[model samples]
Every structure is written in C-alpha cells, then in structure tokens.
Target: MQQLESLIRAAENEVSRQMQVCNACRYCETFCAVFPAMTRRLEFGAADAHYLANLCHNCGACLHACQYAPPHEFAVNVPQAMARVRRETYEAFAWPQPLGALYRRNGVTLALATAGGLALFLLLAIAMKGSLFHEPLAGNFYAIFPHSMLVWMFGAAFGWAVLALAIGAVRFWRGQSPGAVGSAAAVEATKNALALTYLDGGHGDGCNEEDDRFTLARRRFHHLTFYGFMLCFASTCVATLYHYALGLQAPYALTSLPVILGTVGGIGLLIGPAGLLWLNLRRDPMHGDAAQRPMDRAFIVLLFATSLTGLALLAWRDTGAMAALLAVHLGTVMALFLTLPYGKFAHAVYRSAALLKWSIERRQPNRLRIGGD
Candidate 1:
C-alpha cells in the first residue's frame, strides 16, 4: 500500500509540473465544453483549477489540440494529467472492497436486468393495446398505453437510476484528499490542468497539423450518438407528458420523432464501433505501447450489436421479426446502461466531474475572459 501511494504521489507530482508550465492560451476551447466557464476571468487559481478539473469531459479534444510533440514539447497533456488526478482521488476516497464491488459487475448486472424488465413491460403494454403499429407512418403510436402509468413508470425509473448513479459518484469524489503537505499547491495545479483542458480552444497551438482522421471521426460519431439519444429521450418525455399527464391524444406523427432520433443515433453508434474495429484489426498491437485492450474490443462489439439491433427494430416494425429485434435492442440498451459505472462509459461521469472540478479551480480574479476564437 505504501509503495502504491508513493507511485501515485510521484505520478501526481509529474503531472502537476507539466500543467503549471501551461500558458493558458485557450487554444483547445472548442473541444472542451467547460471552456466558456473557465474563461470568465484572465488569471488562473485554485478555484479555477478545481472547476477545470470537473469541467473537462475527457473527450480527448485537448490532446489533439496541443502542438507539443513527444520527447521535446512543453505542451500540456491535459487528459492524462486529469486522469492521474482521478486515479489519486480514487485511491484516497473510494469505498472499501465490498462497497466498491457493488459499483462493479454485480451492480451492473442487476441494473441491466431491471432496465430490461422495464423495457419489456413497456414493449408489452404497447403490444397488448395494439398500439405498436396504430399509426406507424403517422407517429402516434404512444396513444395505446395509459398516459398516467407511462409517465409514472418512466419518470420513476429514470429518476431512480440517475439518483443512484449520482450518489455513487459523490461518494467517489468525496473520498480524495490532498493531505496537509502541499495540499493547496497540488489542488491548485489540479484545477489549472482541468481549466486548461475544459476551457482552452482553437486546437491548442494552432490547427491540427498531425494526422487525426480516426480520432476526429470517433469524436463526431460520439457527438451524433449523444444528440440522437437526447432527441429520443426528449420525445419520450413529451409523449408521456402530453398523452398520459395532460390526457391528450397526441397525433400518431409524434411517434416518428423518437424513431427518427433512434435511427440517427443508431447510425452514429454503429459507425463509431465499426471504425474502431477496423482500426484495431489493421493495427499491429504488439509493435506499439498503445495496444488495444480486449475489453475495448468487447465494448465495440457490444455497441455495434446494440446499434444494429436497434436499427433492425426500426426497419422491421411491422413484421414478426420486429419482436426479436426489439428484444435484442432492449437487451443491448440494458447492457449499455448497466455497464456505465465500470466500463469506458464511466468516463462520461468521471469526465463531467473532472470538468466541473477544473471550472471551480480556475475561478480567479482578473481572469474573467472566456477563452475562444
């Protein structure tokens, strides 16, 4: 344990040193969602550091933005450094084995099962009322279920899931402590790194001079998937509210919204995994230090299956085949959600927290200018 602590401290120190040398030029702002918040002032400080740390979404935008090349560049590797901080935090604050285990495989399995059950229930309700194809083209498919029941079910399920995730994250964050020695400086450095990554824009030094086709494509796919999910989620909320809560029979056309969103989202999700799989297949993993993990491949395969199944459901909504597709789609979605806390998806929550932390750290006087082009 002592050796582990020493290694972590060394890593933190090295990362902090690299960050302090950063000039705050705000070149990577476009990639960072928290840039606007960090640039509220010109000077960087502890608060700003914390905010920046929490604000960074860890999308790898800043890494691509930096002009610093390996072996000679002073360029800040914000993502790596932030990750180090997260690691440190985890070491200091994460709960004991059994509790932490609850956030892992067992927890994910239970959540997936619960989500699958709920989705099955919803799908059944739609089928029983003969609403699945009630107005296939017109989009008013939601008119079949009891509005109140739909609203209550969806609302409660989403609320509970979100709450549980939030609680787990809070506990994780609260576990880290810098200790008394150089605590202030270490925390401040952490904040600065976060701000730099979350708030800086313009691709670091200048335009991306390196070959980043794969990276850019991956990022775009992710963005599209996010937008698609947002649209689907919004449509669900609207349907529930309009049909169930307000007691209004919305048009069949309303159903098309989620379908369209789902289709687009499915496409993006598929593209992302396909691209990654292709890259992994072509690359010689043994030749480089950056070899892909087996789990990475597993994640890609799962996402691909999820997207394809979803698209299949959308394409064959009327046939008996649709039932099987629907089952696969629901299963995959459940798997994705349940894997959230432990898999790469954990980055979604950890990255957001890191960004917010960066935002708070960089909150300094006389540095209120938002960084951007």
Candidate 2:
C-alpha cells in the first residue's frame, strides 16, 4: 500500500511539472487556437487552466511548431496533457445514466444504431410522402413539404445540437478541479507518473520527421473533408431558411445544393481516408511501435465505406440504395461523434483546453527540459 501510494504521488508531481514546462514554452502560442482567447486575461488561475485545457482542438500545429527547438524534445506533449485534463473534467461533472454508461463503453455501436434509426425514419417518411422517387437527379426534394417545415425542423435541430454540445462542454470545464489529485502528495505522484510517461514517450515522440508525413497527409485530407462537409451543411441550411422561413420556392439550382455538396464532400472524404490508410500501411509499425488497434481500424474502414456509399448514391440516385448509403454514412458520423468524448478523438476537445491552460500557468525558470536526456 505504501509503495502504491508513493508511486501515485510521484506520477502526479511529474504531470504537474510537465504542464509547467509546457506553459513556459511560448512558442506553442502560434499554433494554439485558444492562445488568443486566454492571452487577453491578466490573471490566471486553476479555473483558467481547466478552461484552457478544454479549449485545445488537438490540431497538432503546436507539435510541428516546437520541433528542433530547446526543450522541444522534452515532455511537453500538449495533446495528451489536455486530454487528461478533459477526461478529469468529464469524470467530475457528467451526469450518470444508462445512456451515458453506454456512451462510455461501446460508443461506436450506440452511435451507429442511432444514426441508422434516424436514417431509416427519414427515408420512410420520404417514401410515404411519395417523394422518395424523383425525376432529374438534381431536382428539389423539398417540394413535398413546406419549406418552412424543413427550415424550422431540420435547421433548428442542427443549430440546437451544436449549441447544446458547446454549452455542455463549457459547463464541464467550469466544474473540474485543477488537479486530478487533491492533496500535495497526490499531486506529486501525478507529476512523477507524467514524467515517466514523457520519458518513455508514452504520448509517442512528436519530434520525428517521418511522422510528419502522415500528419501532413492527415491534415490535407481533413481540410478537404471539412470544407466539403461545411459546403453541404451550409447549402442545406440556406435552402431550408430561404424556402421555409421566407416561403420562397427556390430554383432547382438552389435546391440541388445538397447533391453538389454531398458529391464534393464525398470526394474529400475518400481522399483523406485513402491517403491515411496508405500512410498507415507504408510505415513500419514494429519500428515505430505505431500499431493501430482493431477499433481504430474499424472506425477508419467504416468512414471509408461511408464515403463510397455516399458517392454511389449520388451516381445511382435510386431511393433504396441512397437510403442504405445514407444510413451507413450517418452511422459512421455518429460513431465518430460518440467516440470523440472518450477515445483518441477526445484530443480535439482537450488539445484546445490544454493550450488555454498552458497560457494561464506562469512559467518557472530552469523548469524546461526535453524527454530522454
């Protein structure tokens, strides 16, 4: 028991120390999205630390920015540190429920199921309205329902989901304690554990030039995919608002935006996954210890499948086939979202937060040092 307690104390101290080191590295400011938001504040505290920790979106810009610099080789892993903080925050505040329990466990399955159900319902409704089968692949599908209904219903739902998630995340951030461990001894333990983790490169070496190849590829693919999704999402939003709210029967060009956006988005989605998969394959996993887990591979494959199906639907325009592909695509998206809070995807939320925390924590002289001597 004494040995165990001592180890824990050592770990806490290490984490705290590394965090301080990261906070001192002002170079990270350029890459960190949250830096601008928190830099304006004169006073920094635990609350600020927690908030900043939650703000990091895990874009990996900081890792690239700090390469080849002093203390660059050191244990200042922004993404991992922020993820730890975000996990602590969520553990501290999320309401306990069966759904939450499921979310924590098999998030992918639950997400897939939810998306599948929604897609089925939507397809069924379209069929019942006799609007599922349409002429001229690019024709407007909203002619059956009042444009007002689509805008008020679909638009409001999407907007509300975004708002709610943002609010929930902020609330969670505000509720967490500064450190995972409460007492001084516990803090020390955490710091030591963090130190050991860094020394071993548990978060993996962020300094490798080879790794950058994959990282850059991922970034390019992601950028394409993101813009594609944004275009499609925005088109839907505009179409709904203009047709429903304003009672305007927009032309086929306006209504066909979803198809156009979907096609573009599909192309990006395919490019990203294909490139990433190639990169993942070409690398020597044994050399770098970069083996992806089955779940991770499954997720990637599902995403690729989703993209393929989306493109197929656009080409075929068969209601039944389109419905199936849409179901799969949405299921994959949901799985991605559900995995976000717990798995690797959590980095998106925590990385930004960590940046904020780093900005808030005052740097101490002689504390900066790279990992592994």
Candidate 3:
C-alpha cells in the first residue's frame, strides 16, 4: 500500500510540475484538449493529475511547440510526463491489480501467451483430425473445431475483456469526479473520441513526434486501425446473425457482405498496425515514457499478427495448410482479445472516458479565468 502511494505521489508530482510550467506558458493551449483542461485548475492534486494524464493524447505536438522544452530550466515535456502517469493509472486501476504487472515485460508475456494459445489450438486440431496434415477442407473452419466450441471459447474471452475494460473505465471515471454530463457534451465527446479530434494537433495538419515537423501519418494510421477493428467486429456480428437468423453456414462467398467486410478490415488492420509499429520504433524517445515500449509493441505486434494470419488463411483456405493457418489465426485473435484489457489497448477506453469528462467540464465555466475569449 505504501509503495503504491509512493508511486502515485511521484507521478502526480511530475505531472503537477509540468502542468504548472505549461499553464504558465500557455503557448500550446490550442494544441489539444489537455492544455485547455489543465487551464481549468489553478493547482493540481493527485486526482487532477490523473485526470489530465488520461486526458492527454501524447501526440508530442506540445513538446515541439513548447519553448521551455528540454534544455530549458523548466524541462517541460507534457507528453512524457503524462505518459508516465498514464502508465501508473493503468496499473493502479486495472481490474485485477496483480495482473497489472503484465504491463512490465509485456512483450515477452504477450509472445509467450500467443505461443501457448497457438500450441493449444494446434494440439486440438491434431486431436480432432487425428493427423497433422489434413486434406484441403475448403472454407469449412468447423471441420477442425465445431462452431459451438469456437463460440464458447472466444465468447468467454471477449466477454471477459469487455467486463475488465468496463470496470477499469468506470473506476477511472469515478476517480475523476466528473459531474453530470450534458447531452450535447456527451455527443461532442463521442464525436471527438470516434474521430480522434485531438490527435489532429487541434488543426487539420498533424502531430509532431521525432521533431518539429508535422505529419498526418499517425492520425491516418489510427483511423485505419480503429475502423478496421470495427469492421472486423461488424463482420463477426453479421456472421453470427447469418448463422442464427439466416441459416447461413461457414465459407461465405467472396461476394458476401461478411467476406468483403472482413477482407477490407483485414487489409486496414495490416496497414494500420504495421504503420504504427514503424512509427513506434522511429518515435523520439523523449516524447513519451520509454518503459512503455514493450506494452505498446506487444499490442501492435498482436494486432498485426492477427490480421496477417487471418488474411493468409483467407488466401489459402483451399490449400492443405488451411487448417494450420486457421489454428494460428484463431490463436492470435484469442491472444489479442485476452490481452485487450491489460495491454496498451486500454488507452483508447480510458482516453474516451476522459474526453467525455473534458467535454462536460469545458461546458462549465472556466474557473481559472486565465484565457480570455
């Protein structure tokens, strides 16, 4: 308990110091929601820092625009400071606190978990078919594992991820002391979250990472990734509806809605995650917390692997390798869903909640009265 408190104090102190400096400068206030939110407070405490940390998008635009950055006496780096506290928040508010340790060495844990899942699925396949090499099974994934069995396995994992993420988001929201949110604010927040308005650097341009140069690559990639995941999810939902409602079975045609959506979404996932992984590697170390690299990379790699394997399975569905590819793809997907809560994916959930709070708070009159309209 004492150790946790100390960690919280350290994060809060760093965030507070940076917020103080940024508030005084107020040059980058137009860059993102974090600055405008920070201006609402004359002083910051643990809760305020926590709220601001999650509210930050860590786009690195503020750092590039800040005159007091680094070599300056203030040593202000908003993205880095907020990132540190954001990591702490993830650990502190994680559904199962003990499992939160996975954030550290997350890459190793993710790889091991994925390997274990793949091996388990492959073993099941071998047991079911009684052979490692089976004849081309066409598009009948149920040949290896029954649809009921697949539903039970993946349904449980997906349900758990949703529950854990919900609990964590609720916990964080309660901690922020958000008052009643107006309907307009709620709609605006939803729009901001879906569009990732803040990541656009508060303008149509883009964010800064390695240097002062602005680039829209990150925002575009994120759009692809987010929409791709959604499309894939929609495909799954449609497939379920077809199975239960329309009596459609496995191996929908290429022209089918489900297949088309999955194909497009898979492509987007490939490009988005690949681009994100590349940017993550090339990103400036000083922009965000360095220690969070493993967590970030773990999620990115899993997403990319999931999409890549799924696409491969689609392309080779009629080949003898189809069964093995299907197992590998299912395993990667299971890993992705299982680790969704504990991985860097939780950032989106928490950030969306923070945006809701910010939008509501912004509706309220600014108490600081620092920036005149």
Best by lDDT: 3
lDDT of 3 by residue, 247-295 (tens): 9997999999999999999999999999998898899999888889989
Tens-digit lDDT track of model 2 for 182-227: 3453444344323322221223332222344323444454456545
lDDT of 1 by residue, 227-274 (tens): 545555665566556566777664434155545565666777777677
lDDT of 2 at 24: 52
TM-score of 2: 0.53
lDDT of 2: 0.46
What's the lDDT for residue 71 in model 3? 98
Output the better candidate (2/3) by TM-score.
3
Q: What are the lDDT scores of the predictions, listed in order?
A: 0.49, 0.46, 0.85
Error of 1 at 341 (Å): 2.8
Residue 230, model 1: lDDT of: 58
- Candidate closer to the true structure by TM-score (higher is better), 1 or 3: 3
Q: Candidate 1 or 2, higher lDDT?
A: 1
Best by TM-score: 3
Cα deviation of 97 in candidate 3 (Å)?
1.9
- Sorted by TM-score (best first), the order is 3, 1, 2
